[model samples]
Target: MQHTDKSLQRKVNFLLYYAVISTSIFLVFILSSFVGKDKNLTADEITVKRITVVGEDNLPRMVLSNETRQHSGRMEGKEFPKRERPAGIIFFTNKGDECGGIVAATTAKDGSVNHGMSFTMDNYHDDQVIQLLNDETYENGKAEVSRGLMFNEYPVGSNLNDRMAKTEELKKIADPKEREAKIGELWDKEGAKRRMFIGRNVNADAGVFLYDAKGKPKMKIYVDKAGNPKIEVRDSTGKYKNIIQQ
Candidate 1:
């Protein structure tokens, strides 16, 4: 009877051990199921100051935000100071450099109302090479407007950092005359050149303006707001003389 009782006690202990082990594994599986499944939520509205979209490699590829929260663009791993960017989307290149973006803004300041929108495509490591823009500034009863497509040219292989450095160096010159001369030299040789402009100039002339390699106005093929047509070419005196209209 003693041996049988001892055997029965051993069986009871084994059953308890098995029950505990099975219960622990079941609990673990239940918890893991909750953790491993993806949950989706639907929402009607979401408010945020900024949103950054990242690549699978965890680097930011795009960003949308207000100017206050906008990321200052970077080139060559160096970021410029935060500038007055409009509310819109900014894009990044594979190298994490600011490539180009779309922006729009309206504001009233100093008794003037200004509104503008722009879409730009930048050159590699440089400023905007092409831009589509519409802009207006209104004061009292008058308005100045610029609306059109523009194309700009930069020095081949010139980057923003080097350009900015040269500009800053020029600013340190104490003599106003010497500084002005140096500035003219810098601009005449290596400045950002306006290659072409197709839009309404400040004078309310809607036309295509062409420039030479030195960015001197070469031709004007446009009509004024008053319906005056001009197909003028630059003369030796550096003036636009109407050839077709005359």
Candidate 2:
């Protein structure tokens, strides 16, 4: 009888152990299912100061924000020396450079408002080989705002960084006159040339102005707001020869 009782007790203990193990496993699986469940979020409104979109390698490709939050077009770890621009979207190249952007601003001090959208292509390691732009600027109490589509070409330099460094060095000059001369020299080295303009001028005239490499308007197809049209022919030196009116 003692032997039989001992065997029965051993069987009961084994059954209890099995029940505990199974119960533990079942509880673990239930907890895991809850943890893996999807969570959905809903919101009525969300506001942010600025948003930066990152590329595959986690580098910034684009940014959207207000003036204070506007990106300064910093690229390749080099910062361009400039002030805060108005609110707009700034785009970055795949190589993390400032390719182009759309910006607008209103200033009380200048009593002016302006907006511009532009796209640029890089050449010789510097931007401004070709530019497509739509820009407008209005001054307080002005008769008409200046708005236009412009194609521009900035003279290329051997090195952008070197030229920028030279500019910074020039800024350190103590004499204002000397600094001004140096500034002119800098511009002469990399002056921007307007190749074409097709839009309304500030004088309320709509026209197409074709320019020469020296930034001279060589030919013009002009039309006033009054519907008067004229074609002006110019010489190689941009001297006007004849005007055909319609």
Candidate 3:
């Protein structure tokens, strides 16, 4: 009976030891989980060089990007100018073409300062047909600023890609002048004519200039630098036909 009591006491001591070890391990695990884990993140601003918003098809639909990484304008069957541009937002059309964008730039170098912004809408397969723009420049101790809205024509039935292809064909001409003349003719035949202008000119004068389809200025209403307001009507040849002043 004494031997049984001793063995039972030993068993009880062993159980207590086991329980202590298990509890210690659980406590250690809980502490380590709290201490070794990362804290919840909080931030006020996130900076990035470029961001592209893609459509459901995983194709880029809009891009907010910088100059160096600017997306070259996309045309399905044609190649286009791939030049560096200012920081801007470029948007793609439903057909996956580069359709429009707003871009701005500022430069202060070599004692000259200049900045500008343009908001443009492009025609299919073509360049900008409408633009709102403001540009300011200071050079040689002179400053010039102009803010304006402009409208240009897009060939009614021609795709821009086809026009680009025509330019390539012009290059096959052996004579440089002949190629240039042909190119100019092609542009005149297919390019959008600047048909309207309204806003402040470089002289800081306000004006509205209206052009005919052939791009001849047919009417002008303006305030001159001397604060004189005038309305000038012109013939299709840009010859002044009448002048009204106030």
TM-score of 3: 0.76
Show the lowest summed lDDT stretch of 10 residues, model 1: 33-42
Candidate 1 accuracy as TM-score: 0.78
Question: Candidates' TM-scores?
Answer: 0.78, 0.69, 0.76
What do the candidate models score in CA lDDT, each in turn?
Answer: 0.87, 0.73, 0.85
In candidate 3, position 62 carries an lDDT of 87
Cα deviation of 17, candidate 3, in Å? 31
**Candidate 3 Cα errors over 4 Å, as ranges:** 1-44, 77-81, 108-111
Which candidate tops lDDT? 1
lDDT of 2 at 145: 52
Which model is ahead, 2 or 3, in terms of TM-score? 3
Tell me the deviation in Å of residue 176 in model 3.
Answer: 2.2
How much does candidate 2 score in TM-score?
0.69
lDDT of 2 at 175: 100
What is the Å distance of residue 60 in model 2 from its true position?
Answer: 1.3
Model 3 has an lDDT value of 0.85
